[model samples]
Target: MWGLVAAGLFALTGYLAGSAVGHLGLMGHPLALRTTHCWTTGPSTTSRGGSTGGDWDCTGLAASGGRTHRITATGFTSYPVSMPVRVAQEPWGSWVPVDQGGWNKAGRALSPLVPLALAVTFARWTLISYRGWRNSRRLPTGSSE
Candidate 1:
């Protein structure tokens, strides 16, 4: 039971770490020219089941203003094909400015703490588990001799 709990905790930490790293990667970047790409939606599935319907995937690849010289982002959306999108530039590509408003902004504010939380959780678990192992090793074994 404890092992299963530990496994779940580790998985959670991994997810948090990935999110923190992704957010940090886009820090201090500029927004992209929105009008350069086309936008559309298609059939999508939710995580609960393979049953499709509840989701509409906005799939579109946008190009840079010939600066980076390639398509930078997918799954972006905008009002008109002629208008620029509200996207932030990342090192590898562009990202929708979802973090700029509402609940997403709250999530963005909390993201930087994930790595620290993960590190602390991992260290505490490691030390506790290691001490338990060491104590078990030092215990006397039962035998009839």
Candidate 2:
């Protein structure tokens, strides 16, 4: 009941926060890689009080023209280390050149999930809350029995 509502709210907050930070370039600009190797850290949790959730992060070693650079990516699921990746320049700076194509591709590949997940959460919570409310209304308000 309240837990579902809180979960939905928290999901919405994360969606908004990630979108805002991603746009502001705090996460970094996307860099296309010809070759790379990624090592994913196990999903980690952030808990305060009763809420619990986690995200996966991967560190990639990308080689471009004989130079290798380290890149980090945060995602809901772990990426295949063998797959080529697009990483962004940190808000401060980066060793890799920022690629507009990579940035656009990253946005296209990743942005859809955020809205979809949030929508699903909203729908679930709405349905559960509605059902609970309707059921409560159908119940005897007073001990007429």
Candidate 3:
């Protein structure tokens, strides 16, 4: 019973954490999300921790507050060229432009599974315990006494 409750807590925490990380532009490089400001091109974007998750080479221009910022991100094959991207600027000045397909939003996509898996595990535990108790309560099929 306590295990189930603990799992529920863990699930909620994980989901919330994932959401926060994702929203904070720390999805690609959560472990090494560098905030140190540096120059990549004409003092436009942050230089460090640009692609800590992988060798992401996607580059594009983001319009934030009417100012265009050059950005390199670890998401999407081809960024949307028509609509204005909901860009997330990291503290280091990295720009993460949101795409339509959601390939980059891994945390938002995967976080809820933590709670789901926990719930399933607890459900299995309960089922097994109930079965064990039921079987224990059963007497011998053909008792002579």
- The number of clashing residue pairs in model 1 is 3
Candidate 1 residue lDDT tens string, 24-68: 334454444444434445546678767543321233444555554
Total backbone clashes of model 3? 0
Candidate 1: where are CA atoms >4 Å away?
1-28, 45-70, 77-82, 91-94, 111-123, 140-145
TM per candidate? 0.50, 0.30, 0.32
Better of 1 and 3 by TM-score: 1
What is the Å distance of residue 58 in model 2 from its true position?
Answer: 1.0
**By TM-score, how accurate is candidate 3?**
0.32
Report the error of model 1 at residue 28, Å: 4.1
Candidate 2: stretches off by over 4 Å? 1-29, 33-53, 64-66, 76-82, 92-145
Assess each prediction's global lDDT (C-alpha) against the native.
Answer: 0.49, 0.53, 0.50
Residue-wise C-alpha lDDT for candidate 2, range 1-145, written one tens digit per residue: 5556556666665665555444334564455544333344444455744533343455557665677776665542334343465555433343322223566547644664665566667767778888887887887879443
Which of candidates 1 and 3 reaches a greater lDDT?
A: 3
**Which 10 consecutive residues of model 3 have the lowest summed lDDT?**
30-39
* Model 3: colliding residue pairs: none
